[model samples]
Target: MKIILSNASSDPIYIQIVNQIRQSILSGELRAGDSLPSIRQLAKDLQVSVITTKRAYEELEKEKLIDSVVGKGCFVSGANKDFIREQRMTRLEEKMVEIIRESKELSMSKQDVLDYLNLLYEEEHTP
Candidate 1:
């Protein structure tokens, strides 16, 4: 797993770590049972405090995205991919609902939102 941290981000260091690892797992870049670097090792590699990585791992463990075994370090949990996808879809729907409500308040039409979204999608996908 590759994790990059940005000092410019508003989120805390631990949250940045958590989000990147979570995305990797959800995207299948980190398969179930894939071993993670030890907390001390990751901290050394990232040049961050061990506490930061530990907190991030703890958060992932709480979400059941990864597991920790005594003396064995951490590994991705064998979670159901369909369940994960469904959870992500539900969150996306909630966000879209809020976006739609805000767009209506701003007098924006569906076409306006679609155009903006398409532009963003293209920008992200552009080489």
Candidate 2:
């Protein structure tokens, strides 16, 4: 597992850690039953306080993305496709709402926004 910290980010260190680990799991970079570094080891590797890593782990556990076993450390939880899809859709909806609000404020027509979105999607999908 790899995590990079940015002092310039407004988000707290623990949140950054949590987000990166969550992304790794979602992207299949980390698989189910994969053992994560111990809290102390991760803290040392990241040069952060152990409390920060512990907090990130706790948050992951609460989200059901990871499971902690006594004396065995934490491991990635089994994937729940439906739950992951729902979570992703919810996040997309929130971002779409923000985009809609911004487009309205800029006086952009619905077709104009759709055209821009299609261009972006095609650009990303194209080689």
Candidate 3:
């Protein structure tokens, strides 16, 4: 998997790493039981501090998305895809609730939000 970092992004470096690695696993690009680069190796490759990579790995481990073995290195968790997807969906639902509340505060109608969502969804899907 290739990880690209963006200096212009608002998110911290570790977050960017975590997000991309999470996407890889979720998309099946990195399948269950697939071995990931070692923390030191990834740190050297990304030209980032070891702490950054460790933090990113720690976050993934916290989500049960990956597992680390003392000597073997980190690998994608063996959890079923449906379970992983459900975990992400739960998080998405929570975020949507916050967004919906904000939309209501701004007097944005349901249709308005739906239209905007449709546009955004289409934009993401468009080639």
Candidate 4:
């Protein structure tokens, strides 16, 4: 597991850590039962306080993306399909909102924007 922190980001260090780990889980990079680094190790690797790393891990546990085992370590949780679908939809809606705003500013027709979307989607999915 790799995490990169940005000192320039407006978000706190813990939030940045949580977001990256969440994204990894959602993207399937971190699968169910995959072991995560210990809080102390993560703090050392990221050069942040142990408290910050613990906070990030706690948030992940709260979201059901990870679980902590006593005397062991944290591991990725088996995510619920419905919850995953909801998260995907939420992210898609956010992107669509941005696309719609940009299209309106450019005076593009709805169909034009949709056609571009389809093209981009196909490009990404093509082998």
lDDT scores in order: 0.94, 0.94, 0.96, 0.92
Q: What residue pairs are clashing in model 4?
A: none
For model 3, the superposed segments whose C-alpha errors exceed 4 Å read: none
Instruction: Put down candidate 3 lDDT per residue, 1-127, tens digits, no spaces.
Output: 9999999999999999999999999998999889999999999999999999999999999999999999999999988788878988999999999989999999999999999999999999999
Give the Å error, residue 40, model 2. Answer: 0.9
State which candidate has the highest lDDT. 3
Tens digits of per-residue lDDT for model 1, 20-125: 9989998889999999999999999999999999999999998789999999999999988887778778979999999999999999999999999999999999
Q: How far is 77's C-alpha from truth in model 1 (Å)? A: 0.6
Error of 3 at 53 (Å): 0.8
Q: Hey, what RMSD does candidate 3 come out at?
A: 1.4
Error of 2 at 54 (Å): 1.1
Residue 112, model 2: lDDT of 100
Model 1 — which ten-residue stretch has the worst lDDT? 79-88
Candidate 2 positional error at 121, Å: 9.4
Question: Each model's TM-score, in the order given?
Answer: 0.82, 0.73, 0.91, 0.68
Task: Name the lDDT value of residue 87 in candidate 4.
Answer: 73
Positional deviation of residue 2's Cα in model 2 after best superposition, in angstroms: 1.0
lDDT of 4 by residue, 4-102 (tens): 999999999999999999888888899999999999999999999999999999989987889999999999999885796797689789998998999
